[model samples]
Target chain A: MEKSAGSVGKVVVDNISKSYDVGRLKEPVLDRCCLTLPAGQLTVLIGPSGCGKSTLINILAGYEKPDSGSITIDGAPVGGPSSDRLVVFQETALFPWMTTFENIVYGPTVQRERLRDEIEKDAAGLLETVGLREFRNKYPSQLSGGMQRRAELARAMINQPRLMLLDEPFRGLDAMTRELMQEYFLRLYEDKGQTSLFVTSEIDEAIFLADTLLLMSARPGRVIKSMPITLPRPRVPSMLTSTEYLRYKEEALDILHEEALKAFEGGSQAAADFVEAYEERETVG
Target chain B: MSLGATSTNAASNKSIPGQQVGEDWLYRAQRALTTPMPYLGIAGIAMFILFWYLTTEYFKLPRFVKLPGPVEVWTEFTNPDPIYGTSMYTFDYYKHIAWSSLRVMLAFALATGLGVPLGLYMGWKKKFKDYVFPIIEVLRPIPVLAWVPLAILMMPGREAPIIFLAFLAAFFATTLNAMLGVESIDESYFRASQCLGSTPWNVFKRVVVPGALPDIFTGLQIGVGVAWFSLVAAEMVSGEHGLGFLIWDSYVLSQYPVIVIAMVTLGLVGYVYSLLIRIVGRSLMRWTQKGQA
Candidate 1:
């Protein structure tokens, strides 16, 4: 795995703000949220629920446009979807009608401006890389959730995007499957060396997957902390058990914990009730 | 082998379900025979036929009131002209059956060809839906028979009403099904296609059509059934050479056997058409049984 001590490339986020129309009124989701995703490195965005981590990803993916700020990919203004940037959603976005092989090959086949034989070879190689070569003919529903994620990974990779945005890709997987998928993703990133921006709630996942972790605060979300992970390349699960990993995890957790408490106190009935119940139990103890 | 070992093997074999090799024709035959309705139906039909033969042949009732037995109907099927007399235009029962089947096939094809694409487009793109769906909704609830007067007024000839009625029967059911099929398709599939750089046309052709096919086929089966029903009603009014017309003409002349024959023909044609539609649907959606992606 290639290790770069300094920044790889520049991702400029210039005063981006977003608001959603909840019924008739506009509810502010992100207020001038400014953060850079270093190119050629994995950047993990962490925040409390409804903190606009997903909204940021959507803006980056060209699915949504921010009201004020602009996102530039390598100095070009991000306008809309292009082959240069890709997104892997938490849900398995595989086409139900297509087989695993077909789903993987779809990108190349549609972009048939490329040579057909070359596209086929690339898809086959990707299937092998994802350990799904044997089940290439199988449909998405036949595969386990982890395997489906692998297919989604293969489909996203087939396009060979410069920037890949993942929105909690392994959030719903069982613990064992989640670890397996994380390792798979690590290997993929190492092999492909593509810049990725991963949005996740799990502090450990952020620590493990990111070269830099961008922690954002609650609604009207803005980047509160940007912690550079000085962890070495090709970091394994065993590295997660290290003191450095634990320390980084604790730091991230501390930031997230503060945001969680703030969110709980700030007039959210469900959150307030939860915090009150917990405090009551603590006082009794 | 040891006695315990032998017993254990026997028990295991008993616990395991038996797998049949090749086609189990005997099992299928047994299942067919054991079906509750067919046995009861056969018994009821036999009793009816016996009563008809006894009452008509033995009682010697008035000729108009007392119809011929099943044997007479079968003989009329073999040599229809003498039994049905000159009033019935067709030489045999098979001729009328063939004519009705042909009309149904043509009408069904026309209805499906027109309805499927219109339904797909209406269901898929929201912009087109506002314009197209309202029109379909207005036209759909109106009965096929209700269209008869308008069809007669608008159409230049007799052929038009028959075809119009057949189209009416098929169009609404097929359109409804097609729209529903498209509506029910997993949206993620379309989104995935878009992400893969699929053009709108490719998405419709590859993703939308196939995803909606199971529902489309269901609509087609229903549409064909409705088409046959409409054909019968249409034929009664405007048909010159169909089973419906044959029934009407025979009833006018009081040739009861010919009327019964025409009724049987209509039922048989409807049954056969439905079976064909089902077979086609099953084959088309064979992959669905396996599972979704």
Candidate 2:
């Protein structure tokens, strides 16, 4: 295991801005969004729909470039995609033609940095870790939606990337499956302590999984608030009901509620839902 | 019957909604035989044959007066001493089948060999597509039969001209479909490949080829059918020993029953070619098959 120091995984996004030209109009998505993913920590980015969370992840993964401003990982300027930063896409991008084991072994085999036997051995362990050992021979289409996601995780993990970018990785899963996946993900993250940026829309999911929760403003998005969760390690379901957890949730909700109203004025549906959720929480509390 | 075989082969080794796992081919064949669809198809063919029989033999209608009855055609096709000098017992019947089949196979092979690579390159590179696509677009709309005269003029031998016509028909279909196949692949797959440390060449090898296979096979299927269609047309126009020539020669001799036999032979051979392509497609694309159970 090529174990580097924890400091090696720091990622810095400095004054990044991106926009798409929609016919005659220029649609600004990310407006000088700046944030840092500290080494050996999971940072959760939550915001309203169309808030450019995915765009940030895309830029971090080096799939797309920012209009102006730069991104760096551990002081080195990031260019195109490399094995150092692996992204688990929201829609499960496992190659349909390749089996689960084959997808997991793809990075090492293609890069040719590891021995063939060594790559296979590590891939086998990753498959086991992700609980997809039984489905090693199954293609992406053959696996269920959740199984496919797990297979993708294993595929990315085998590369031992310094930073992991998850673009709403558990978005479409059913409630029960989504909860289970979150726990499963936290377990893996705790074991490796790799720098991870998790982008999501769900408030509970953002609160439960993140070491630091960074909430962004509505479109032309930029990080508006960064709150560190002081809850103890090996977080449990019991923590959800704890006073400290509620305190943090309340603090986060207050900031998000203000931003949601700004978004609601601009005709955003997700912002309306957030306001509604905040009002319901206030009445109940 | 050939339609039933093709469908069954496509549905084979697949766990479709209504199909049972571990079911043998014989059992499926039995099911096909007993199905309402097959019965309806048989009845339809029987009705067509009955209409032909009534018009030519029973009614002796004025419009069908020149055409031979089903019985006469059948008898002539099966006879050891055919008056038309072409029958199941004659070596010339087999020779015609061989010539047509060989020419179509060669043309299809050549088209696939050249067209697939050309299309893949065109799809992969924007500059390559810009340089080549306009010529193909202009050439493709011109019918394969329209090239028959030019093909004969360009090529020296009878075989070359017929093969050239067939090749042109298959090439356009194959190349266009393969190009569309590459375009059909999702943008995310390419992004995923690049993120996983694949080089430009590896991306082409790993992402482009397999991702485009289903469409490539579709192209192959359409191409093979067109190859047969153009081969027959080419043979009919030029000097040849193929089934197309056999049909024309029988007509010139007024061996009307022999002409019907040749048409039937052509239909059977074309169906077999499509069935072969479908079977190969199924075998190569096991990943496309749904749940194993």
Candidate 3:
């Protein structure tokens, strides 16, 4: 199958606010969050821990209804989970019962937007692209963590969704594996350029992958800053020490530190770790 | 995601080589049969029989002097023309075995057919559970044998009462475990299916059924075992022809070796049933074995 480049329209999340009922208390997570993912761009959502990135992703994916506001793709209001917006979850959700090939074919096959034979052919192609052709018959549990995540990516891409939501897709992998996955994912994103909302807590990752970087506030999160990353395409590992990458990193870390302090004042231990982690990274660099 | 393929998911501590996934089922079965585990299991059974023989046959302790020894039971079991009519060589013994097997089979089938669907719906929908769970809670705790008097009163014949008693025992176990199985699945799978544009029915078919199977089979195993237990009790109370009836009749007639023979047959048949369930469960849940190689 030839690469189908860039068909998704802009995704506008307009003032989405959400909270959960905890006992008698109403705990707000996302506070009137607003952002725009431009067509065919990799938009990275970076925030401190507990800043409700997953909640916003959930809202965007239509898995949960926001308390107020709306999400639109090409002027169509997002009401519920649909094939148009697919999410690659933080924890691997490859349907442990299904083999890698089955999982990749699941979305299109279930949606009935394409024929089974066509989907199977495309799935076979995707398996080769993801380098999982040899492992296609294996179940999720039998594959390595990185392989599962890659299979998840293939599963989402096969749907050809207008928007892709990734919630820290590599959160738990070792640092080395995480970097390699990021590059591998970056290559796929560059080739297809699907409009994406990628969530992460790592500033370096955000700078490495984002065409447009979004920084969210502490708790009750909303977009506090949006900046365009002018780095060249086909990002390389050596960019970690480049002046341009470091510049983006410094700005992101500053905003993140301020948000961490806000959350710390609000008595979040997770924010304390967030602040300390960046500080340690600063000293080491 | 990784080209290396060496690192496995954290959920599985051990990873079987991918090549093993393609091994033929019959080859694997042959290997399993040839393993040392079965021989060790046989040795364990032999030791247990030896202990029984020492106590009841050779030692003749006061507590066991009346109890029939393993040798006496074995002799009657293998005898072509035994004195007692309830030996393995006799048609009467086969009739008892067949009756007990048929009742247990009927009870297990009825309970599983009704219980699994009810349990799945109960766990899937809050309204359904609210309407039904309280009734189950109140009725489940009542012992199976306790239902005998009411069952006999409600049902006309000896067969109906015995089967009803056995059904009640199996039903509670199957229902509760199937419910627990549905509840045990991670929430993310449901969410993932929704995002992938699966219909509500598809979610139930693709997610709910396969996800709950492991627990459903567990319930079936326990349910079948409990059904056998209650079936025997019901037979002893009201049965005219079954292994339980044979044992009771032997006791009354002072046919001590026949009672021992009936008891051993029950154990053997029950063991075979449990093993059959486990084999079926393993085949249905092939994915679960990927990490255990």
Deviation (Å) of A236 in candidate 1: 1.5
Q: Per-residue lDDT for A104-150 in model 1, tens only?
A: 87777777778867877888888888899988767677888999999
Per-candidate TM-score against the hidden true structure: 0.83, 0.92, 0.91
Alpha-carbon runs more than 4 Å astray in model 3: A1-5, A21-25, A277-285, B1-23, B27-43, B291-293
**Candidate 2 residue pairs in backbone clash:** none
CAPRI quality band, candidate 3: acceptable
In candidate 3, position A176 carries an lDDT of 88
Evaluated against the true structure, the overall lDDT of model 2 is 0.85
Docking tier of model 1: it is: incorrect
Question: For residues A15-125, could you state the per-residue lDDT of candidate 2 as single tens digits?
Answer: 999999999999999998999999988899998888899989988988789999989899999988888999999998888877777778888877989887798788888
Can you tell me the DockQ of model 3?
0.45
For model 3 chain B, where is the 10-residue window of minimal lDDT?
B1-10
lDDT of each: 0.77, 0.85, 0.85
Q: What is the TM-score of chain A alone in each candidate?
A: 0.90, 0.95, 0.95
